[model samples]
Target: MTIYGSALIVFVLMALPLYGLLLTSFQPEAVIRSRDVQFLPATLYLDHFRSVLAPGHIVPIREGIWNSVVVSTLTAAVCLIVALPAAYALSRLRLPGKNLMLGAMVSVYFLPTTIFLIPMFVLFVSWGIDDTFFSLVLAYAGFILPFEVWILKTFIDRLPREVEDAARMDGCTHLQVMRHILLPLVRPGILAGFIFAFILSWTEFLTPLIFTSDIKISTVALGMFRSTIDIQVGQQAAAAVLTLLPVALLMIVFQRLITQVLMAGADR
Candidate 1:
C-alpha cells in the first residue's frame, strides 16, 4: 500500500507537466495569446505543428535535427569505444589500484561539468576545433565515458569467469572471445550505455552553447531558443514537443532493453 501510494504520487507529479505540454501543443494560437491556462481545450489546432515543421529559422528545424542526431550518435559510439576496454580491464584484469581509479572516475563524474567548460573551450580553440561537431562530440563523450565505463564494468564483473576461461581453453583468442561471447552477452548494457550517452549529448545545453557557433551545426536544444523567440506560444509548445519526439521514440523502442540493463546491475 505504501509503495502504491508513493507510485501514485510520483505519477501525478510527472503527469502534470506532460498534461500541460499536451494541452498547450493542441491549443490554438489565439487561445494561447489570451494568456489563460486551460487544463482542457474545447478543441484542437495544428497550425503550430505546421509552423514547427516549416523552415523559417536561422537554423532550419531539419538541420538542427540532423546535427543533434550526428553529434549524439558519434558521442555514444566513441564513448563506448573508449569505455569498453577500460571497463573490461578494470573488471577482469589485475590492474594496479583499480578501486582507486574507479573512485577517481566516479569523482570526476560527480564533479560539475561546468567547472571544466572554460578550460575545455580554451583547449578546443587552441586546437582550432572550437564550435565544431567534433568538439561537441568529444566534450559529450568525455563527460559520458565515466558512467558508461562504470555501467559496463558492473556488467562485466557479473559475467562468469569460467565461461571466458573455457573459451580460452578451446583456443579462442581473447579478442575472439570478447567479440563473439562477452560483447553479445552484455549487449543490453551496451545498448543502454549508448542510449544514455546519446540522450546526454542530445539534451545537453551548456556544452553545445559553449562549443557551437555556426547555425548550421547547432543542435535541437540550442535551436529551440532561436526558433521560438518571435513565435507564438502554440508554436513554441509544438517545437518543444517535437524536440522530445526522438527521445520518446527511442525510449519506446528500447524500453525493455534498458529495463534489463538497469536491473542487471541492481541485483549486485
Candidate 2:
C-alpha cells in the first residue's frame, strides 16, 4: 500500500503539469487570459490549434518543423556513425589513456553548454558556416556523440564475445564479424541512443537560437520563442503541444526499452 501510494503521488506530481497543458491547449482564450482553472470544459475550443496551423504566419511552421526534423535526423545519424566505431574500439581493444579520454568526454558533456557557445560561435563565424543546418547538426552531434559512445560501449561490453570469437575462427574478418553479429545483438542500445539523441536535438532551443540568424532556417523550438509574444496563451499552448506530441509518442513506444537500457547501464 505504501509503495502504491508513493507511485500514485509521483504520478500525480509528474502528470499534473502535462494534463494542465493539454487542457489549456483546448481551452478558450478568455479562460486562459482570465487565469481560471477549469478542470473540465463544456466544449473543446480548437481555434488556438487552428491559429497555430493557419496559413500566413511570421514563423513558418512547416519550414521550421522540416528544419528540426533534418537537424535531429542528421544529429542522430552522425552520432551513431562516430560512436559505433569509437565504442567498439574502447570495448574490444586496449587503448592508451582510455579512462582519461572517457573522463574528458564526460566532462565535456556534463559542462554547461553556455561554456562553449561564444568560442564555438566565433569558430563557426571564421569558417563562414554559422547559422546553417550543417553547423547545427555538427554542434548537436558533438554533444550526442559522447553519450552515445558511453551507452554503446557499456552495452557492447555486456554482449557475449564468444560469438565474435567463433566467427573469427570461421575465417570472418573483424569488420565482417561486427557487421554480421555484434550490431544485430546491440540493436536495443542503438535504438535507445538514437531516440534519446533525436529528442535532445529536436528539443534544443538555446543552441539553435544563439547560432541561427535566419527566420526561415529556425527550428520549431526557436519558432516558439518568436511567436510567444505575438500569439495568445492558448495558441502558444497548442504550438507547445504540437512540438511535444511526436517526442511524447516516441518515448511512449520505446519507454520499456529505455528503462531496461538505464537499468543495464546502472548495473554495468
Candidate 3:
C-alpha cells in the first residue's frame, strides 16, 4: 500500500475505538437497550456521568479517583527511587553474588500475587496498616518494584561506562557520578519504569480487594467493580471512563517521551 494509505489505516484503527468509547459514554440507557446500536447516541444524557460522580454513590467515584491517583503516583515515585539505584548497582557494579541477587529479584516477578494475598492481609492487620492508604501504597510499591528494577536495569546496562569513568577521574564519587552523569542519560528508562509502575498500581484490583476494607483506601478499579456488582451498569461505565481519563491524558501529554522510552533498548 501507499504511505498515505498506511497512515489512513493506522488512524482509523486507533480512532475507531476511542470514538466508540466517547459515543458510549454520552449514550442514554434507552439507546443501550435498543436492539440495534448506533455509532452515535440519539439523545445525549449526562445522567450517567452525574450518577457516577454523585456523592451518594456506593463507592464515592471521585474519592476513588483521588485514591487511585495518590496510590499510583506514590507507587511510581517509590519504584523509581528504589529501582534506579538498585538497577544501576546491579548493572554497573561487580558485587559478590550479583547474578544470584538479580535472579532473586527476577524470581519475585514470577511468583503469583494470589499466593501472598492472605499472608499480606495478615501482616497488614498485624502492623495496624490495614484499611489505610499507606497499606495500599505499600502493597502497590512492592507489587511494581521487581519488574521496574528489571526493566530499568536493562536500560542502565546499555549506558556507556566511559561517562562514569570520566566522572571518577575528576575525583567524583559514585553517588556524585550517578546524580550528575548517569541520571540525565537514563531519563528515558526512568520515565518508562515510572509509567509502568503507575499503570500497574492504578489498575491493580486483587491486592486492594483483599487488604483494604475502607472506602478511603479503595482505588478506582476496585470501586468500578464494586459498582458493577450492584448492577449499576451506566454508572459503572461512567466510572470506567473516568478511570481511563488520566491514563489517556498521560499518553497524550507525554507521547514523545513514552515513545522514546519504549524504543530505547531496541537497538541492543
| All candidates: TM-score | 0.90, 0.94, 0.86
In candidate 2, what are the lDDT values of residues 17-89, reduced to their tens digit? 9988898899888887775567776478898878787766764565777888889999999999999988888
Candidate 1 accuracy as lDDT? 0.84
lDDT for each of the candidates? 0.84, 0.85, 0.83
Give the clashing residue pairs of candidate 2, or none.
none
Positional deviation of residue 232's Cα in model 2 after best superposition, in angstroms = 0.4
- Local error of candidate 2 at residue 221 (angstroms): 0.9
Give residue 263's lDDT in candidate 3 (0 to 100): 76
TM-score of 2: 0.94
State the lDDT at 74 in candidate 1: 94
Q: Which segments of model 3 are wrong by more than 4 Å?
A: 1-21, 259-268
The count of residue-pair clashes in candidate 2 stands at 0
Residue 141, model 1: Cα distance from true site in angstroms? 0.6
Model number with the top TM-score: 2
Worst 10 residues of 2 by lDDT: 55-64
Measured on C-alpha atoms, candidate 3 has an lDDT of: 0.83
Clashes of 1: 0
lDDT tens readout by residue for model 3, 162-232: 97998899999999999999999998888888888887888888988888778766788888778767744
